[model samples]
Target: MSLWGKTDSFTYIMNQTKNLGLAVNVISDYDRTNANEYIKRKNVLVIIPSLVENSPYTVYECLINNVNFLASNVGGIPELIPQEHHAEVLFIPTPVDLYGKIHYRLKNININQGLLNHKTILKKLGLSQLNEKTTGAFKKIDEANSPLVSVCITHFERHHLLQQALASIKSQTYQNIEVILVDDGSTTEDSHRYLNLIENDFNSRGWKIVRSSNNYLGAARNLAARHASGEYLMFMDDDNVAKPFEVETFVTAALNSGADVLTTPSDLIFGEEFPSPFRKMTHCWLPLGPDLNIASFSNCFGDANALIRKEVFEKVGGFTEDYGLGHEDWEFFAKISLQGYKLQIVPEPLFWYRVANSGMLLSGNKSKNNYRSFRPFMDENVKYNYAMGLIPSYLEKIQELESEVKSLAEHQWWSFCQ
Candidate 1:
């Protein structure tokens, strides 16, 4: 098939070649030498559409000569295809029912359908579109106080959860907000399903999801904020339900209290496990000082319900993404406090925060994501533990952690506080 000007077909083929480093040549009645050269090269990719006239025979001749191929699955062309072409020749779904087909293709966004199951490919396309929309909106914000409010969330194979999370913002009472959902390397069908459902609606509702790979929550949220256009930034959790006044409350707090960061009291309900030590901390939540420098910020806000003015956030360098899962928010408050920024909380609960254990957390995600990222915080934790003589309880683990810190810090893997 021809590259066929600037269109989806052309973009799809070009992106494939660009990403995989495969060469594609849309051929014509070319001479024997050129055809032979293409046939001999194992890397060259050829795309043939069954809808094109008499092209299956031509593509078959090239395939028999050992040319790599991708054929559009259309009509009865498969009946006449050559044997050697079976493996390399991919049958792609043909465009149909232009209006209805596009609509159906869109509905396939959820990845429940067979043809649209190529979610990784679809996500790349989705991310590309996200980049276009986000870049333009971001460019308008010359500084941190851009008119848009950026609410960042991370998601994996939880479209059911994401659809609700995204809808909360899209349906938010505050209309001048932008929602940025970061994928964090989710290749699952559910991820794409959520993407398709949220994509057009998000764009229409003035929310945009930043398309990303598996960078973990800290990195994903940080990455999304870097692309935000609003004067205020709210860090959000995907599984939680926000009240319509969530953003409005945050903004009002920021404006009235003249504080840099504001968060609401979250109402959390635990599952069957009762409550872990970490989960217990979520109870008896209190409002931290409006000026964190004047008092302590031990419980500023869970990553679940924190919002900050963009300038103060930028000033404190956002969340330390390298912290992975745990204590990233703690480090954020510490650094922001050290920078003399105020952190306050709303007295009322404006979000339904679900406190539960995730499979990933139980299946080593907590460890892996936190391992390298938490090393820096562990150093400080160690210093305190050793000073308080709590080292006896953790002698072996401390030694191991100490060695890791020494090796990584010696190599400058982490930027120590200057």
Candidate 2:
């Protein structure tokens, strides 16, 4: 038996399996090459006994390679498996259940059916094989006709992170782009020095560095928007890294949909880890359809890292200058939504959102007063509807009946005493 993985848990598993007098060949360095080679071996069965998972890619890889696999029937794992193959592929996480399922699968394994199941899932996910000859050719838009996108990035003292963010923007597939970096009052010498170096280095690229005095996040974004000279404005935090095709995708989506405001999903990367094409987790936020009712209670809308038409942004009066409050993005989206502007989600993860241990969101969450301050900014009609929506019609009726019963009981008691 072979065990392949790179995390600390994988090491623990390797040691535990050996301690139990089991001969397990453990490959500590886990990568696609090693995994692919192992899967190609004759008469092999992959077992994923995860207690909790979210659409694991291991199952997909096994299916793609026509290899038999037994996975726990846990979060999103069952959804990936075809309905017909459920009894064969999925098993309970317990050792007894796993062993039984493993024995059953080894005895009745059908490689052809597994391949067919893989193809079915691929088709379902819109990833089926494409014919290059019949596929439409790429049409290049005229240079003059292509819209210029201004990527407005707000920065504080994290110059290192800002450099990464700028590098990502510089690597965009769409060439007709200008970057506006807002330096929101950095007190550190290292940050200041790095900003100056970048200002000189990127001056030839038509990128401008706007300086501000401790104006906070919202105001910093507004400052960047003010200096922008493009038809479309894209906002990004300093910690975010845009994908190579992000600008191109947003431009194409904008033109095709004619949406005034556009937002895309992002991959949530923890700590300082760089974004990888193969790394995907279910922990990230997925933008839902536009619903003002849901938006009132939570940010159903996309993140602040969004693409917007310059005219629409100007019309909405830009982001609110609410310093230290993290819900500025939510409030700005709600404001534009209230004004009947079209806010559309692109449904593709176009960038990487770095989630650090301590950031503005953590600080904002610590203060209970933040949401209270934000409530006044919402529309009165929306607030009333949101409050009313919380109580069900049956619950309201029950409350009314209870009130009447209490009043009647008090009157009877007074009458009996008299």
Best by TM-score: 2
RMSD of each: 26.3, 18.6
For residue 249, what is the lDDT in candidate 2?
88
Model 2 scores a C-alpha lDDT of: 0.79
Best by lDDT: 2
Worst window of 10 by summed lDDT in candidate 2: 365-374
Question: lDDT tens digits, residues 29-48, model 1?
Answer: 77978777765565444456
Residue-pair clashes per prediction, in order, are 6, 0
Q: Write down the TM-score of every candidate.
A: 0.49, 0.58
Flag regions of model 1 displaced more than 4 Å: 1-147, 270-284, 287-301, 359-418
TM-score, predicted candidate 2 vs. hidden true structure: 0.58
RMSD to native, candidate 2: 18.6
Model 1 residue pairs with clashes: 110-193, 148-230, 184-213, 184-214, 185-213, 185-214
Q: How far is candidate 1 from the true structure (C-alpha RMSD, Å)?
A: 26.3
> Mind giving the per-residue lDDT tens digits that candidate 2 earns over 263-373?
988888878766765666656778885677776555778888999999999998988787666778777887777778999998889999888898877766423323532
